[model samples]
Target chain A: MMAVARAKSRKADEANNPSSQVLRFGADKPLILEAGVKLAPFQIAYETYGELNADKSNAVLICHALTGDQYVASTNPVTGKPGWWEVLIGPGKIIDTNRFFVISPNVIGSCLGSTGPASTNPATGKPYGLDLPIITIRDMVRAQAMLVDHFGIDQLFCVIGGSMGGMQVLEWTSTYPDRVFSALPMATGTRHSAQNIAFYEAGRQAVMADPNWRGGKYIEAGVRPEKGLAVARMIAHITYLSEVALHRKFGRNLQDRQKLTFSFDADFQIESYLRHQGMTFVDRFDANSYLYLSRAMDYFDMAADHDGQLAAAFKNTKTRFCVVSFTSDWHFPTEESRALVHALNASGAPVSFVEIETDRGHDAFLLDEPELFSAIGGFVASAARAKGLA
Target chain B: MSVNSNPRIDLQVVADLIPDNAKVLDVGCSDGELLELLRNQKNIDGRGVEISQRGVNECVARGLSVIQGDADTDLVYYPDNSFDYALLSQTLQATRNPRAVLEHLLRIGEHAIVSFPNFGHWSVRTSLFFNGRMPVTKDLPYSWYDTPNIHFCTIRDFVVLCDEVGAKVEKAVAINANGQKMGFSMPWWFWNFFGQQAVFLLRR
Candidate 1:
């Protein structure tokens, strides 16, 4: 019944937004999800750049962080803005679309065209909403693996990502160690820190607090829950940046006011900036999808899959690894990257670590940091040499 | 030691001591010149830890797999028996606890190759005895205020440190101020008195 409702919801969503590029898969060989539910008749929306070599060894998978979509090096269909990672993934950029085929997909539970809470249930014929089973990072990777399998590629030359995307990179490497030639997990940790979980909880509460949410049935109830989603994005955005970055970007400067009028109407420049950020975000993103994706991030724990020994996740893994972190990123600091390096060393896996000197915080990987690019480019070139690619 | 005829003369000896295709960790590997040589000449799998950011950048630019890390704190990250040899060329003197560093090196690798400028060379003694000031020889050229060699020791002192740390000296060689390797038949005391630097291969 819920599946039928989901199918109906998907049809309604399709009618509302007719340009969702998707790849459909039958339920014959469902990607076994962590929740023990075999989802079939599912679809994954993805965008690819460059050409896959005859051997398919030059394929590179670029996973995305929270709120990032598959439009990696192209214009976003929803926002009309350039791709999120344009700096890192382009024709001659660090990831080098000219040299390697890059694939970016909207993860399993996201607002971007991929199957998520907004996606219809094949059984219930309505949006899955609360009916959709909560997903984990491993589940997200499993879906991506299915997408990779569809392309008939035996092994990827490299898999790289930052933040939540980095979590997927690690999950993919651990779950299918032999399939990934090299792995780069930047600005991420093996497990969600307690503080991060608290932040996510705050975001979730903010969404649930709005009456327009209508118990997550707002779409069918003719409401958008914009206020709740905006508040959630506001709180979540603060975590993606550092105090140093915020101070530098907005400081205490007033917004369009000569002096302190002292009205709560965004009296500070930072307040006006965050409000603008929150408002623009709701225009393109869905509320329920945000909740589901946030939960997935919270559920991620790599060591849990290996019986509490993180090193065991990469036991004798032949895949080379390069872990990266920024100095001022308090959310995912260099210490987390060192822990990852320590685990790789314990597993006897060959690994390289670079703690880039940056004050841009956790969002540094998505920015123009020359050191990050050089480190990544150098690692990729060396790995290519090892893989016998020119 | 800037006064030495060639700072790399001791590195040449270290490169020769290492076998082909061996797994080596070069701690405090500034600029990774030795690692690059080992990779090309001996086909060894080399990794490096350098303290300075500039050194790491140079190593990376040269296609060396090096991480920016201090030897005093980062050695604990490497697993025991992970490398066939651990090299600390001209770096042991700069460490805060030389004995602990040596012990960690022995535990992490099958053998530890260490080289340091010997403070007991005759020139250093002459400066102390006559000038009543710290040596300004080719090997120990820096003024006391600017010197980074905080735990300077001689060949005899290092041998005693090895003994106390339960590390057996597999081999030893001393290079004179002219950068010539001293004869193996020469007593360690003779090398201590005349040689400007000493290199030792130690094992637990």
Candidate 2:
């Protein structure tokens, strides 16, 4: 369903003149990654709505998910779609951008304006590809912190995200406890589960198995791995939704035909819909960046870093936390959120939790779920009051 | 008197028991009226555990820290002495094991505040005595088969359970049918028969 916009030059142009502001850090201020590598002379592309108050306490950092970019509440220049979280963020919406200064940064390892596998490497004058040092969730948060520092925001009013973005939120609260006033990590977990790693492995294999992949050097080859990346996107898309959501959207109904044409073509409506999702995703997302971001999610285990105690990761943290999950989200289920709440309780952190009842599954965080909106709105308002914000 | 004044009376009593700047956990805090009251009046840091998703949502929308959790199964996740007070208002009887849940409350907080409808009130006793069936009054409005109050207890019974569980009653208040407090010097049986509901403050 998407126009073919997979050319290397088009993506490079997006990197050069991103739709939003870009913050650059020279070799003097290198980002020390968790992988024991230093990434210098990098830049972070971000979008800002609303104004930072005099005290700078009104800033809210919005971290995007695995494939999400910095276009949080504006139009994306590449795909021409509305910002991913426009449903919950705007002038008078749930997050209330009119009052709170909202900042959304394209992560360091994503295919967006950020320096990812698709960005030109300073050393070789080519796309970093696999040469880009592996980035972790901690690494992504560290890079965003530099952007926050650029604005002179000592502490963010709130840090919010779902799925992979949620992982970054947790990392911010854990690593830089004093820098965040409040945190909302929804539809996520402390560590990637075995099942999550298995699903991502299947998607990564799909990308690598295609002949056009060229061993992660497809951009230099002048032929993108369209089929491989499409298959990978399709595999990951199924995990984002629940079986009930799939059934409700597309049951056993045929794809615009009187009877089944069972010849390996798109016979079922679900098949056609999945194909559209995959095809649309490859146009905007880079294939090798997908592999790197998913691997970063796989390596995220906060508890392991803190001597096998998740509570220890948040020791003596004064930041208020509000954890949210969906009932039908088996990908990152309510049980995972409960585990996070339990850790926060053990650490004596001010925390609240809610498990929203919805059939929409993990993607419910991104959809028009009123209950999620109310929960986030209420929590944000209360936190704002606590911060003495008008 | 209007009907709403009475419930407010006991809730006010629960709010009065807490001090300023205290960390409070309101177990079974349906919609968080009591916690909200404490937060506004006493300036206490309040948290809540509600059993229903709807109740939890409503509580959160009011800016109260609430989680959807069953009192029977979820209290074990809390650390010891985490709060200044833990409250179980009108929700103790609905638990599967009221004794164990009470023990958990005491363990999780420095003090526990409990409130429940007394089954030995004259109206409840008279209904069962004359009708020869489970009582259904204004306070206890459900039949035995459909009632969520499975582990029902009277004022005297709760006091005995508190003693059995090694908890000392720091303070106790009994509210009569008209939402008036009974005499403080009265014996347990007098409050058990005359009082409609009771609120107790206990500590280990």
Candidate 3:
């Protein structure tokens, strides 16, 4: 759909211009892994909008979710649609590209423009595949720190994201407390709940069950494993929507049929929607990349990192926090977000929390929810004033 | 930090009770003027919770960290001793559960500063005694049907509640219609009738 946008970039030289392209880093500054390994010559695909002011404090890092790439306010190259959060981070929008510099980078494990399992291995002269070091949220953040340093920015005006993106935001705040002026983590939890992990495992299993997967070496085997990946996507998509949203959108209505055919084909509108979502997702996302990112989320445990004391993770943190949760988001419910707020409070870190009443569920952060927009707008504006951007 | 030279007398009294540089939470902090005052002037660490989104927006606009939440429900989320002081100004009477919120404030902070409109004031009494209608005054301006104040109480009633909840009243001040502090030595009945508002410093 957005083929035109991608086609133009190939003809244009991608030397060192800071518009939109893949920039390889971490060679001289290799990322030391939590697994006691080193990932060198790695690359990060990122896109930047607005202008970094002279003081360089106007930079706002926008982290994407598990499947999202670095298309914050623009059209996604894969789907040709406006970026997932254009409602929140665009010109004159809440994040306000007109006022602040925005940077969105594809996470390390994802398949977009970033180095992932699909990237060629410099050592072996083959696809890295499963050889790509398992990345944690912190690893993604450390890479972002490198990107921010590339711009000569010492501190960010704000680090904002939702879902897994929110997890990265938290990691950024805890890891580089002095660098972030304000943080907004929306519809996310500090750690993946057992139930959430169970769901992710289900998706991972669906990917693994495919004979075409070839045990994570599908890229080198020249196989797509579309079936298992589609099943995974279908299962994962259900968690992102609330029962209310599902009922409102579909409500058992047949998919372009007046009556059920009584076959294995989709009879309900929700079923057809999920199938469509699955098919479209397989066209863009990578199967092994999905496995690696999902596992990364399951492995995330901020409290466990701080010796089981969540407050210790935020000891002496100066970054102001704004945590948001939606009412019907059972996946990462309001209670989960409150835990982060409670930890921040115990550490005496300044934090604000809003449990927005919405039936939109986990995906509410991606949608055009007015409360989220206003809250983020007010928060960024305030942080900007405090950062001397006023 | 140029402190506001003139603050609302009730808020000024509330501000005086907070120690400099102490962490504080202001429940139902409408637009966060008191939080702004304490944060800028005394260098106190303060956050706030306001039920209305509009109030939260305004507070955030002024660079005050305020969350949109209800004190009655959200107070229980904070850990014990999270703040040095918990300030509730002109909000106690309007709470859905005054006792529970008060208990949380006292438990969550080393001390609490609670200020509310005195329903037993002489004007409200005379209006009820003579006019025989739900008394409306500058303090309790809302009529019975539309007021957010669900659990209205007098100064004496709040003092009774403190004892019931095992919280000691460290200091209590009553302000009149003109915002002048009344003598503490006065009898409860006299203060209840004459005072327009009451401020209390409580500790467990």
Candidate 4:
């Protein structure tokens, strides 16, 4: 089955004219990690919405959340759906594609044409599976920096993302503060809490419990652990929402008919919603990639480099930061964002924080919230004007 | 020269009160216009603390050295006696803990310039007494529920609070709504009769 998928992908690549392509940078290969492992020939899949200006000052990097692809404002060829962030990025939208060069890349450890667990290892010509080197958020930012350097962008007008994408945005500022002029890290924390890591652990356990998984070699064994992957996605989806949002969106409501079937089938609207979420997620994502990405998130502790003082991590940062969080996102609560703000304040860094009132949970950053749009739009516009882009 | 270039308060009053070449901190320094005036006109070495990111960006765009920080929570980062004067023009009333903050300003600077809306002015007083509701005057635009000015203070109330904190007043100037200076004798009535704002220079 693995060989068949590869053959199908090759045939599709040859038969179907390329509508889009991922641009490469650096030495055309992945660099070795500090963990004493080499990840060679890794590629980044990216999509661009607008033309780069002559001076390249209009370049803006847009980081995508977990499970999100590089398609920012274009239609995704896989699902035949509109871009995930179409509402925020368009000709005249808040992000304003007409005025900015937007780049969204499928992050490393993701399955969308990027090197991940599912990608074949050149050494053995088989999927890396559990053998893929554990990549960190900083590693992702380093790859992105290479991409930005390839584009000849000396200074990014702004780096913007939310959730895991927001984590990358923070990393870009800390690791390459001179390159990033402004940063908008929305609905993200400096590090994943123990509770968050526990959730990821539970999801991984759910996937491994399925017999078809066969210890992460299901693809080589010619079997797909769809049920296990779906269940894992279902459990993870529950964490991405707030209790208020769940109550408002589904409130013990029945799925089709008013009466409960009293059976094992999905009886409540939330249960049906979870089932749909799980089934759709399994279709596009690789299960092993999910494990790798979640582990990467669990290991993400930005302050560990600064001697356990989060404020010290930003002492030398000169990038203007706009930290935003939703009121009802309990997964990465407003308190978490406040902690980041407190650190920035202690470091004497220029920072602005706005906890917008919303019941959209952690995913509010992706939705069509007028308040979020206005805050980001206003911040970016001001930052651009300061950089003389306007 | 232009109507838009005029300061929100009496420019001459601020200039007269702020000493020449004194290190000054301006909270809520919108657009850095006041800071620009202090730098070019008064020749004061001015630093600003503005809450709005847009405001801070504008300040930086104008080549002014300003930090983006909230006066309510970010002021404690500064060391004691960091500046000769801390100016809170039309911003003290908006703070969550105005009394404690005024004490902090006095502790952080040799002197403090505290200015706010005269809530006990005739119009606001009448509005609440006669109309039986929160006043929505020019100085206070939002309704009570949404207003950022959580602690409304009057000129007389401020003077009493300053006395209680052992802060001596160097100069107290009240201005009419038209920005004209009012005489000291019954200035509240004169302010009620004509003035709209007040500025106080205090010494600890």
User: Highest lDDT, which number?
Assistant: 2
Q: Distance from true position, residue A349, model 4, in Å?
A: 3.0
What does fnat come to for each candidate?
0.32, 0.63, 0.46, 0.03
Indicate the TM-score of model 4. Answer: 0.80
Looking at model 3, residue A24 earns an lDDT score of 81
Estimate the lDDT of model 2.
0.89
lDDT of 2 by residue, B96-154 (tens): 99999999999999999999888788877777788898876564567779988898888
Candidate 1 error regions (>4 Å)? A1-21, B1-6, B136-147
Better-scoring candidate (DockQ), 2 or 3 = 2
Q: Model 3 chain B, poorest ten-residue lDDT window? A: B1-10
Best by the TM-score measure: 2
Q: In terms of docking quality, how is candidate 1 classified?
A: medium
Top candidate (DockQ) = 2
Q: Label model 3 with its docking quality class.
A: acceptable
DockQ value for model 4: 0.15
- lDDT accuracy of residue A267 in candidate 3: 88
Candidate 3 iRMSD, 1 decimal: 2.6
- Pick the winner on DockQ between candidates 3 and 4: 3
Candidate 4 residues A178-252, lDDT tens each? 898888898999999898899889989988898988888876786667788899898888988888989998999
Query: Each model's TM-score, in the order given?
Result: 0.94, 0.97, 0.86, 0.80
Better of 1 and 3 by lDDT: 1
Model 4 chain A: weakest 10-residue lDDT segment is A10-19
Of 2 and 4, the candidate ranking higher by lDDT: 2
Error of 1 at B22 (Å): 0.8
